[model samples]
Target: MSTTPVNVQIPSDTEAPIIADFVEHALRVAYFDRQHWASLPSSDWDAPGVYILMTADGSSRVYVGQARKLRGRLQQHNNKEKLPWRRALAVKRDTTAGFNTAEIGYLEGRIAAELNALHQITVIEGQTSGDETLPKHMMISLDAFVKSILGALRLAGLDISRSNPQTLTEDEQPTSAPVPSNKPNKTVTVADLVSSGLLQAGQALFLSQAGKEAEGSVTADGEIIVRGVSYKSPSTAAAKALELQSSNGWMAWKVGSQSGPPLDMLRQQWLIQQTEEAEK
Candidate 1:
């Protein structure tokens, strides 16, 4: 529901057709003019759909679209104070005529399907799951991420969230010295892992988030469950790895038999060896 009322006004005399085309694309993908389409008695309210308006007066134009809670979305457009994307469309030519002009929505596909189908500048008060081609995780807001961070720190038994050692009741503080970092700030050269047989050709590991998924050696030494979700890790002993966005890599990633841990455990051993060697 990140909808903001955007108000970018391109002259109707010049932008009318452009608006129409934009609306047409968005109608197929992002938004719809639900009021006009669903108001009729014949319309099946239960059916998921979309509707939107295209702005044009014989020549130039603009297009505006909305979805999710159709009534609320459209109300924002009419009111010009929702998300900025909606406000941008509301000020086209005559404020009253923007919605009244040629509109399109619910032309084809389910509501989400149609909304995404249009590719229009969408203004909705809810999150739109990007298409099936995309991953499922939503972008968490900073506030939510912070809350999760606090929870994760507590779970890991780390006092990093606290301002000072005295903040704790003292029984919660660990008496042992903190573990030393084995990884040198220096980068591990690409050749290092290759020389150690950590990564094998056609090994099929995503090197990093940015790296392609083709194939790489199993150098990420860690014990990864075979049937459960496989996560990406910053280090061999990392408490948690960034969860893989694509396939359930836990099942997809394999070494010999699917029963034992992922080859990553062996890789993790290699990392531990390197860290110990560096410490010495």
Candidate 2:
């Protein structure tokens, strides 16, 4: 038997946090602020999966559960004003053969147990062990699923695991070029990059997330195009590609290939040139 290692990439702070690590069945876990959840189209929520709801005020309180159809279940949670949940982490398979009842139940049970053991966050529900009678083969297959879910939760800034813990500082966080304004900090626009020869107009841009890929191109002006829509800011274009409210396009997007340098790196080079010229 042979195994291939998969890399887990942390999302930029400016982007909605999602951890889609290597797992069978195309497992993906995405974080959603409560408003983000509410804003999603109805079709987005119509899936069978497990979810963890977290309190809004940074309370570390959370509830883990599974549903056959996430839309109805999440809506019910929304109505319970007393529940005090402010955001959610949803897990689903991107394959045609989605999770069955027992599979999600098993995942929910295992996920809750993992959270409970961590003792870093409070698990609001009692006895989350669901469908424990799965066959041996199924349990073996689900082991990776459990690992990926916990990994996703950890990467999403939850202290749900002890392995490879990470803490990012304010300056260390990734951010796009400041939004265009009449102010002086506007020197780092895509147009500026083009003028400075850091990027050529009509050059291709790439962004890959959770095994999915998107392509955009630098327009002649400062904007970029994705799916025929032109956006004024890279972060906005990245957000559009990811279907999220915001993303640090500087970090989320690559110059040309999946392995290309992020826009932030190019922006830094431009800034360095500016500093040298100022000194001269």
Candidate 3:
């Protein structure tokens, strides 16, 4: 499937009971208090996804869960007052075909882990490591989706993390070619890689590690575009897509498919040919 750009719309006022919609990818997150949640229509949240209930008090307690139908699952929480959760963030895929059981299970486990790592909030829920047996590509897609959810939480004034979830940090930006004092640098672009027949225009590329996944495409001009942003080199593209300080794109991204050979393999082949010609 062709990768689409992610566009998330968040509300300006976090105090208001509102639903911040990620319109393009249909990753919808509704933030509301008890009264606002009770007033929402059940039909709108009938899809499968994960939900988070958090305390507004200074306790910073949270509960993460998954369900087939968010409406029914959340309703159960509303009837029971044991958790003392004052605010809720109900997340659901706003698409015709939404998440499956296994997908939500995977998200539940992943989200729980992310929260635990934050060290700010104490998860009130029991130990839940959901089913993680999913395809590589699917896991990558879900990881990106999870980022969107985290972004929404950040917008709602939750101190989830110190860094912005969506924005690439200054250190994460792609570095320029190194220019030596004696000689001018020969900048290597995706065009150079493709001219060597190592890559094709419009070829799909992906990076996956530690349950995080990112996708990009090789353009006709030899630049790799990730999340609608273009980069001059594969390393920069991989770093930007993966939101890392730096990455060796040639090794980080897989060409053509998720299970395909690492880009470095093709780079090695091209370097070998260059060496052979230089020796002659």
Best by lDDT, which number? 3
Task: List the candidate 1 regions with Cα displacement exceeding 4 Å.
Answer: 1-179, 184-193, 204-252
Selected candidate, larger lDDT, 1 vs 2: 2
Name the candidate that leads on TM-score. 3
- Return the lDDT, model 2, position 110: 70
1 or 3, which is superior by TM-score? Answer: 3
Better of 1 and 3 by lDDT: 3
Each prediction's RMSD over C-alphas, in Å, is: 17.7, 18.4, 9.4
lDDT for model 2, on a 0 to 1 scale?
A: 0.68
> What local lDDT score does residue 130 receive in model 2, on the 0 to 100 scale?
56
lDDT of each: 0.29, 0.68, 0.69
Q: Alpha-carbon error at 4 in model 1, in Å?
A: 45
Could you tell which candidate, 2 or 3, scores higher by TM-score?
Answer: 3
Candidate 2 local lDDT, 1-280, one digit each (tens): 2242445545565344444635554876666676556543456557888888888677787888899987678788887753588777788776777899989987887777657645567888824555757774565466456666776666567776443212212123234433223223433666667888998776789998755679887765556766544565787777767876556687888998888998888887776666566556
In each prediction, how many residue pairs overlap at the backbone (N, C-alpha, C within less than 3 A)?
A: 49, 0, 0
Candidate 1 structure, TM-score to reference:
0.20
Q: Among all windows of ten consecutive residues in candidate 1, which has the lowest summed lDDT? A: 134-143
TM-score for each candidate, following the candidate numbering: 0.20, 0.50, 0.57
